[model samples]
Target: MFDLNCNLRRGISRHYAIDKITDNHPIVKSSKKRIDKEYSKFAGILIDVFYDYLLVKNWEIYSDTIFADFTTEIYQSFQKYSGDIPPAARQIIGCMVDGDWLISYQHLDGVENALDRIDYRIRAKMGARIKLVDAMLILQRESIDLERDFHAFFPELQQHILNFSLG
Candidate 1:
């Protein structure tokens, strides 16, 4: 139990570190800036989702494994580690696997659906009215630039993780 708790803490710390690195990276910041002012406040969240779509769309360039196989493996890992996962994350994992959310990142409608869900959550939790559903237009308009930024940034992020692991 001690080891399990330590490992969970480490994993959560690493997740936050990666998020900070991604959020502060210059290329990522530029990608956020490319989004219209209407979504300036939510640009980070939108870019994160958009980047997932980009990653899935360009998966062949980054990984030898089939995307479906990769996502399946991830879902299996979630199940395998279900006992160790925090309750909140476990709930999300259930929804993600049931909806095939990772695989859905490859499609425009899937991306729109994700944004809509986020919008709904924000409205429900914060009473903030946001039209993240309309972010699809911005995504379409800025895809070329966003993809270019992603290509430049992802390799750096991979290296950062490698270094983080080694350290």
Candidate 2:
């Protein structure tokens, strides 16, 4: 999944020529290792974060029925794959599965709150000073473009995860 996200970023970068990372190079391999390490440390939090963004924003594209019900079903699939997620994310997933955080990323405040929670956990565990506000600003700035890319990317990702879970 992390590799998929990285590849998606690389694909998106081709259009903008904004990313510094190059694909299939030694540097890219090293970067992916670092990325994988962070991902494992976070224990699959990015999967929920990215999927939540897609589920909320692209809800209409994926469903013609009630949003809540559709979200429930999708999240249930996520729950089946939640064993690898860290304890912190497991708790968040419980809330999300129960609809407590239903589409929170739909609003700026929700984004901030989510970033805060992530920053808190990462800081607690690693004592790293990840300036979440800085991260939030980048997301806010490129939201439109990012959403466009996400719309193009998320469906395939959803299917991939579902297939992986079933396998």
Candidate 3:
């Protein structure tokens, strides 16, 4: 099994995780669902969406990219219940670097999207907040020492990420 220790960051109830890839215990288990109400779902989706981009850019995902790619969900996770309850899926990001898997998550608190039929059980399903300025992340990967460059380059996303946490 892949060691999951030291692969997570949390604020209040929010979290970001970077998992070392493993063939023994795949980071994305075979018993999980695509729309499962877990926060990690968000991580899974993000890595997939950006897999080609990450590869084309040639950024070595350390044992710490916090995002990985695994494209298959032909199985069911543990949380599947007997009753046909409404699905409350969360958004997460996952990717691969040097064959290591990374995962990122955002809690679904204070989300502007109203839940019409979602129950409290799955309503707390945390996910990433789709930001308007994520288009600039492509530039952030250009350098490990992207200090002032990002601050000056992507002030909008930097501010939004900070403000979202504060607000």
Better of 1 and 2 by lDDT: 1
The root-mean-square deviation over C-alpha atoms between each candidate and the true structure, in angstroms, is 2.0, 11.0, 16.8
Candidates, ranked, lDDT: 1, 2, 3
Q: Which is better, 2 or 3, measured by TM-score? A: 2
Query: lDDT per residue, candidate 2, 107-144, as tens digits?
Result: 66766677677788778888976545345554555456
Give the alpha carbon lDDT tens digit for every residue of 52-95 in model 3. 23332333431234223321220121122212223332111111
Cα error of candidate 3 at position 160, Å: 30
Model 1: residues with Cα > 4 Å off, grouped in runs: 1-7
Error of 2 at 31 (Å): 15
lDDT against the true structure, each candidate: 0.90, 0.54, 0.27
Best by lDDT, which number? Answer: 1
Global CA lDDT of candidate 1, please?
0.90
